[model samples]
Target: MAVVTTAVRSGLLFPLFLLSIDASFQRKSGTKTQNIGSFWNGSTGRSERGTELSCCALINVQMRQVFPIHAQQTRPKKECRDRLVQYNDQLDAVLGELEHHPEILLRAVVADGQYAKDLFVETVTGHGFALISKLQRNANLNYVYDGPDQQRRGPKRKHDGKVTFADLSRFDVVNESAAERILTQVVWGVRWKRLLRVVVIQVLDHHGQVIKYAVLFSTDITMSASEVVALYRSRFEIEYVFRDGKQFLGLQDAQMRTQQALESHWNLTLLVMNLARLEALRANNGAQTLVFGVEDLKRRAYNALFAQVILVNLGLEARFEELIANPSGPLNFGLKAA
Candidate 1:
């Protein structure tokens, strides 16, 4: 039987997945479908050069989702006077609908900086459990630790202001797996960045050269040696969804002027992508290998569907002209998931 079982559970419809495993199960050489749950939050620019006001649900930590939110143009254009509200209100409703069903345990939430509100944080925490999130990061994070003597030191008199990426980078340790010295390097500064932290995990590979295991996170959890690595690695799957959605899913080709249309279309696309993933998984005899990478998805789905065809064609025309004059090689349009 597959060790990783994904299920939707309880009245919460909370997208819960189970991964309870025994040692005997691991010893056997069988396929294990680990329950993948992630709350992916982020925003996208409505237009290539327009405001990035789009954010929505992501599956398996995938960044491929659409918001059913709408807003009106209310600034700069005195002639086009209107009241603009973010689509977050609608996205919140969608999440609320999903939250009622408690099957989804590992909720992967995605939102922009503005969505990091106090109420949002409380709502998610009310469930008594949920993994790390992009919601408000340093609100009262200075509260004391509460693990056993073997873990935390209980409550303290005061908090250490707020832990910054810079402070964490200075700390390092020898990993248990390969006994390599792992270092956490800060990529973004708290004062300068909204997310407060963005670090990368690096270690010397078989060769002495430093290798980036993955980009680190912004959570305040007491990261164990393996936890840091796990968090970083988890981000890759989300990125895959983004790349595939944009390239094959035609996420960037949206032309809807009103926000509601934009949001509904976006949500539909993600739903379609998930269904396709399920279809592909079944077709492959239950092997979890992702055959549909970003490139494949673009050619098969986005290119076949979405309206960015004219724009993409025009962009390629300009590139082709440039290549003819100063050819280097095929330009790498997309690679990283984020």
Candidate 2:
């Protein structure tokens, strides 16, 4: 229940277009461990074979505020004494919270390949939200038949053939590299039980040979292929949040043992992130176009605290926020002596 139960912004509320959620792991290695479990630490690009707390954080599309709504310590299958819970169950809890609050107006959920499974897709869609994520490179997809059928058939043609890069046709070209080495395709994903829209982006060498490609899809087939690619691309916003939280905000700095302590520390870090944003926005007079950031807010806070100490020692009755907002202004250090 750490979810934000109140509106984040003021005036002319807009529909929340995208909500990006992903798990962040804290690497832990110690003698005494309680709820610690081995989890994937993406920052290291390798499996963290030690105890880690898998935290799920949700971010607004514009990177306005990030909320760590749910977190559970990952438990290794062999060491787990009780039933092991997956990200899907935690994500369901998050979606369920949003469902009760219609004012949030969440339209779609954006995540990485980790959440591209059928269970996650069905769970997200069940909450009336579209799932935007990438499919594995070797995904088993088949083209559904829409062509004229032959009378001689038993189960009928469920698939045209195995879909490969060479045989796929591009319905529309979404992007082209300046060097003419990359092409993005938006086409119907054939061969799957459910009709889906897929985006195939291929990078070719100078010889026009396929070097790399990405296949992104959306459960809400009505969305254009371009929209699918864009939404999936925005999923990285949460990744950036994790990076900032770790590097600047000390997201992975805690070393608590109990579940309550671990959860509290994780939630507190995310709460600080949101509070910094809220403070920054207020500092900018609620202007979304401003360039204020969390670091800047931290810097201002440091100055404000220093100025408050100085003002209190001098028996001054002036506002410390003015000094914080404009440290070099006349009111801060230029005030006339009594």
Candidate 3:
């Protein structure tokens, strides 16, 4: 919460937040690690034995910054088998935490296809926030009945017919280009048993043939199709948070065995990453777009620390300002050129 307040003061966060919910697996060795369970590792393209962390992150769409608000270790269903540790259950906890911060106006919750289930959708929408997520290409959907109600039937008509991508006569073409065609419609999800704003993107080949396609949906039927697509694309930014936390920070290098210690370590690693990025943004004068290099920041920090040690040992601390002013001084050594 302090970090979020700092971001708000720095003008880095917008009023309308786009929250992303996802999970990442960290491979750990040894039997002493608490809550360690097998999970699917996307980097390896297969399921591996590891611990999973489910995170809810806020994405600054304009600045392209991702800040993790909350994260918790998720145990495999086959092991702990408790509903409280399930994905949707963890999401409820995240939402509950956000409820205390009324200043954060969450516009929508974005996620991938794995979270497109009925419970997840209902959980997000129940909080009065829209949900933008991908749908399986072969999901069962039907066109809403627009004709007259059944005058002689016990129940009212609901579905006109099944929806087919090959025949999009019922959908409106909202966007079109040489590369793809975007169509949208308010259709009924057969599995979810609810109306959804569905968007379909048809990727075109060199000859304009649809070689591939993808389906996206939003719980808010009033949301624009383009906005839904853009929000869903921003969901990928959370993956970068995980990538940086593991590769640059010591997200997976924690030696802690206890659950409390491991959770603290993981959150600290992510918090440090966020702070470093925030410092970079400040140094750049809060530019709308700037290049961020965690490696370069680390190098500068190391150089400064080394210089401080040398200055203190040589009793030249009084001349620190003068020495640092030189372009080729020790304080600037090993620092990346701007």
Candidate 4:
């Protein structure tokens, strides 16, 4: 939270922050490891038979830059888990960190369809944040009753009728393209028991027929439909953090069995990635557009370390600056071309 606050204060990051929440499974072994259970392997798109740790993360997305705020293990199931912490409970832990930094302008909390439950939505909205997420295609939704009420009614009518996706004429068409159509309406969610600004995306085929559709909703009814769609799309940026951590930062390489040791390793792995991103942004000096490649950063660091070790071993440390000053020297050996 301090790092995020500093970035916002220093003008490196915008005041608006969109919190993206998701979980990833880390493959682990050994009978002594705690909280190990069958978790969904996103890479393989299936539940792995082997034991794994369910790590949930909160990422702050601003344009192209992603800042990882918190990550911890959550129990995948309540039946066999010793310490049964639900996903919503782990999310509350992440939100607790944000509460300390009230100055940060948080716009909304975006998650996937898995978090579209009433409890999760209430948790996010309770934190004074607008919850934006995907809902089931056939979610139980009803149009808000806008007609005149009866003069002698016992109670006012709340819902008019069930919402039908095939008949979007009642809804407002916000966007249309060759690929899909975006329609929105302020309706009452039966299951959620609240008003929702729902966006229905009707995907089109080559012949312009409706092949399938998706449903996205936000608690903020005043938010525009296009903005909701765009924000939900940006939620995928958090997945990159998990990808880089596992591939380059050894996110699943921990050998520890205890919860504390594993948590420390997970935090350190993501923290290093966050530091690297901050360094990259600092090097760019707040440029509007800058290419950030983690692989290139790793390559440059390796080259610098290799050059420093060879210079010190050869008793040529005095000439290190001159050697590195040369553009074609060892320090620049394997860097990608700009």
lDDT of every model, 2 decimals: 0.37, 0.63, 0.81, 0.78
What does the lDDT come to for candidate 2? 0.63
User: lDDT tens string, model 2, 1-338?
Assistant: 22343424453113354766677777666757665656666768886655555555555555344555566665566776422246677778888877776557676888888777777777888888888888887776665556778799587666565556565663457566633332343234433346666677777677767777787788787887666766677666666566767778887777777767777777687777766655555555543564434555565556567777788998873866565456456332432231
Better of 1 and 2 by lDDT: 2
* Model 2: number of backbone collisions: 5
Off by over 4 Å in 3: 82-85, 148-156, 299-338
TM-score, candidate 3, is: 0.86
Which residues of candidate 2, in runs, are more than 4 Å off?
A: 1-9, 62-65, 81-85, 149-158, 179-192, 204-210, 290-293, 305-338
lDDT of 3: 0.81
Q: Which ten residues in a row have the lowest lDDT in candidate 2?
A: 178-187
Clashing pairs in 3: none
Give the Å error, residue 227, model 4.
1.2
lDDT of 1 by residue, 163-215 (tens): 44223434454352342455442232233232223333445577655553333
Per-prediction TM-score, please?
0.46, 0.79, 0.86, 0.87
| Candidate 3 lDDT by residue in tens digits, 164-262 | 888888899999999999999999988978889999999998899999999999989999899888888888889888887887787888788777887
